[model samples]
Target: MGVKALLSKPLAAYVHKKDRSWIENPVEAQQAVFKSIVRKAQATRFGRDHGFSAISSHADFVQAVPVRDYEGLSSYFNRVKQGEKDVLWPGKPLYLAKTSGTTSGTKYIPITSDSISNHINGARNALLAYVHETGNSAFLDGKLIFLSGSPELEEIGGIKTGRLSGIANHHVPGYLRTNQLPSYQTNCIEDWETKLDQIIEETIDQNMTLISGIPPWVQMYFDKLMRQTGKPIKDIFPNFQLFVYGGVNFEPYRKKLFESIGKEVDSIELFPASEGFFAYQNQQQDKGLLLLLNDGIFYEFIPVEEYFKENPTRLTIGEVEPGVNYALVISSNAGLWSYSIGDTVKFTSIKPYKVVVSGRIKHFISAFGEHVIGEEVEKAMQRTMAKFPTVELIEFTVAPHVSQDKGASFHEWLVEFSREPQNLEAFTDELDQQLQKLNSYYYDLISGNILQRLKITGLPRGTFRDYMKSQGKLGGQNKVPRLSNDRKLADGLLGVAKL
Candidate 1:
C-alpha cells in the first residue's frame, strides 16, 4: 500500500482510542477539561476576578460565574482587541474570527493558540472517526475540496481578522495542501460570485473525492457547474463519496442537494461556529452529533423553558437529560466565561453526549404565545414539501403579521421556490397541518381563534439571494433569518422582492 493509505491506520487507531475513553465516561472527561481550563486561566483577569483560583469543583465554578451573552462579554473582548494581554485568556489572541453578524453588528471572537488547536484537532478527529467507521482509505488518494471564504485576512486593532473558514484554511497542514482544491490564489478572491467562477474553472476537471461546505453555496456551485458542462455532478467527479457540511440544518436542503449530486453519498454534519467546534456526526448509524466533551470548551446548559427568567438554572454535563431543549453556554479557553452563543440544542444521548441543534434563542416566533422554534418550523417544512414532489424550496422566512387590517394576527411565510406548487392553497394547508401536529401552542392558538391561519407569499426566484446581497452579507456563513419575532426582516425581504 502507498504511504497515504498507510497513514490512515495509525490515525484511525488514535481516534478510536480517544473516542472510546470519552464515550465510556463523558462526565469524567468534561470535568477534567474544566479543571485544566481553570488551572491554565487562573491567573487571567476573568479567572482571578471570578475566584477561579479558589475554585476546586464544578459547583464552586458555577457559583462563581454567571451566564453571559455576546452583549455581556463585549467589554472584555473590546479590551482584548485594544491589545490587552491576559485579559480573557493568557496573553493576547493570535487572531480574531469575525462573525457574519446576521442578527446584529459584527463580533470579533478571539482565536488563541490553544483554542485553534482544539479546532484543528476536533476537525481532524472527525474525519478520522469517519474513516475508522467506514474503512474508506481511498478517499485520501484523491483531492478533497473545502469550499470556503477568501483566505486574505485583514488587520483589525493590530490583530489579524477573517472569517472562521479562512482562518482555518491558513492553518491547513502543509502535507494536506496537495490534495486540497481551489489553489490559494483562487481562495483569495473577495467577491463570492467571482470566487465561485474561479473555483469552478480551477476544479471542474480535478480528481475531487470529498467536498466540504455549507449546503446552499455548494448547491449553487453544483448548479453552475451543471449549467456549464451540461452534465450532472457525479459525471464530473465520479469519485466524490463524502459530503461534509455545517452552519445550517441539512434537512431543508437535502433533497435538492441529492438531486444535484444525482447519486447517494455519505454525509457528515458538524456544529461549528466562530466560538468553537462544538459537535460532529460521529457514527453513520446515529442521527445526532457526538458532543466534544474533552475539547477546551466547558459546557453549561439552561433549560429553554426557563431561559428568560430572572435567573435560570445552569446545568452541567452530568445534569443534562435527553429530549429537553437547552440554551448552550460555554466557558472556553478562548477567554469567554459562561457565555451563551444564542443557540439552543436538544440532547439525544446522555451516555456519550449526542445532540442536535434545535434553534436560536433570539430567532423564534412567539408573537401570540406560540413560542415556535426553528426545529418545529423546519420539520413542518419538511413534511409539507414531502407531499409536493414537483416543488423544491429555495429559501423561506416567517414572521407575524400583527396589523389589524385583517382583524386578526397571523403568521406570514415568504417562500422562494425553484418549482411552483400545483396548488398554492393546498400547499399552505399542508404546511399548517404539519405545524399543528408539531407544536401544541400553535395548534391551540389556531384552534381557539386567538391567531389566524398561517399565510404564505410566493416570492419570485432569487429573493433571498438578493436580500443577502443588498445587506452586504452575500456569502460565507451568512444566512437569511428563518424565523423572526418581528416583521422587520420579513418586510425588508418582501420589499426587496418587489424591487
Candidate 2:
C-alpha cells in the first residue's frame, strides 16, 4: 500500500470510533448540542428577543421561537446582511451562504466559525466511514474531484459570501489539496458549461478515483466524457471507485449513471444544504444516511401531514419514529433558530438515527386532494424503469394538469428520454401503475374517477437544460423539481416543450 493509504486506515478507524461515541448516545448528544448553541447565543439579539435566557427545555425553546422559512426570518437576516453584529449570532458571521430561493429572490444563510465544522467534518467523516468499513483507502492516493460551484467569494457586510459549495471550497483540507482536481482557476470559471469543459480537459487523463456532485451535473460530465473518448467513465478513470453525491435522490439517475460508468461502484449519498450538512450514508449496505446528532445542530421533526396546520407538532430527535415522513426543522450553531429548510425525511433506522430525504415540503403535486411527493414519483419511476431495461431517462418532472373544456384532469409527467422505450404507452402505463401503488391518495383519485391516468410528454433532449439556462440556474446545486402543485412550471415547460 502507498504511504497515504497506509496512514488513512488508522485515521478512518479513529474518526469512525469518535463518530460512534456520539452515534450511540444520540439523545444525550442532541441535548448537549441543543443546550450548547442555545446557551452560547443567549446574549445575541435574536436569542434575547426569543427569550433564550429563560428557556430551560424543548418546550420553552419552542414557545420562544417559531419555525420560520427564509421569508419569515428575512428581517433578522436583513439586519445581519447590513453589518449588524450580534443580530442573529454573536459578533459577525464567518461567511454567508448565498442560495437561490423560490418565493424570495436570494437567500443569505449565515455560516459561523463554530458551525463551519459541521459542514466540513460531515463530508470528511462520510469518506472516513467508507474507508473504515471497506478498508479501501487506495482512492485517497489518486485524484478526487468535487464538481461544485466557483470557489470565488464576494463580500457582503464584511463576510465572505458565495454558494454553499463555493464556500466549502475555501476549506478543503491541506492533506487532500494535491489530490483534489480541476485546478483552482478552472473551478472559479463561473459559467458551468465552460467550467465543465475545462474540468474534462484537466482531469481527462489524470488518476481520478473519486467523483462528487449532484447527479444531474455529474451525469452531464459523464456524457461529455463519453462523447470525447467514446468510452465509459470506468475505462477513462479505471481507479475511480467512489461516487459521492447529494441534493437529489440517485435512483432516478442510477441506471443511466451506471451505464455511463460501465459498472457498479460504491456510492455515498449526503444530505447537505446551504443551511447545514445534516446526514451522510455511513454504510455501504444501508440506503439510510446517518443523521449527524452531535454536530452543532439540534433537529426537530414535524409530521409532513401536519406541516401546513396552524401549529404543527414538533418532535425532537428522541421523539421521531421510523417510517413517518416529517418536515425537518433545525436550530443550528449557524444562528438559524427553529428554521425550516423545507426538506422532508423519513427515518429508516432509529437505532443510530438514519433517514432518507423524502421530498421538499413545497415541492409536491396536490392540485387535487391527492398530494404526491418527490419520493413517490422518483420511486415510481425507478420501479417502472427497472421493468424496461432498454429505456434510458435523462430527467423528468411531474405536474398536475387540470382540464378546462369538461375533460378529466390528470398528472402530466414531463420526461426527457435518452433512449426511447420500445413501447412508450406501456412505459407510461407501468409508471402510472407504480405511482398508484405508492401513493394511496393518488390511487383513490384515479380509482374514484376524480382524475384520469397520468400522461407522459417526451421533452426534447435538452429541454430541461434550456429551461434551466433560461431561468439562469444552469448548474451548481440547482435541480428541476420532481413534483409541483401548480401549473406555473407546467405552463412554462409546455411553452418550451417544442412538441
The local distance difference test score of model 2 is 0.92
The TM-score of predicted model 1 comes to 0.97
Candidate 1, residue 86: CA error in Å? Answer: 0.5
lDDT by residue (15-125, candidate 2, tens digit) is 988888888999999999999999999999998889999988999998889999999999999999988999888999999999998667889999998999999999999
lDDT of 1 by residue, 190-259 (tens): 7888889999998999988899998888888998999999988999999899999988888889998899
Clashes of each: 0, 0
**TM-score of candidate 2 relative to the true fold:** 0.98
In model 2, the runs with Cα more than 4 Å from the true position are 405-407
Could you report the Cα RMSD, in angstroms, for every candidate shown? 1.4, 1.0
Off by over 4 Å in 1: 405-407
Error of 2 at 326 (Å): 0.3
The lDDT leader among the candidates is: 2
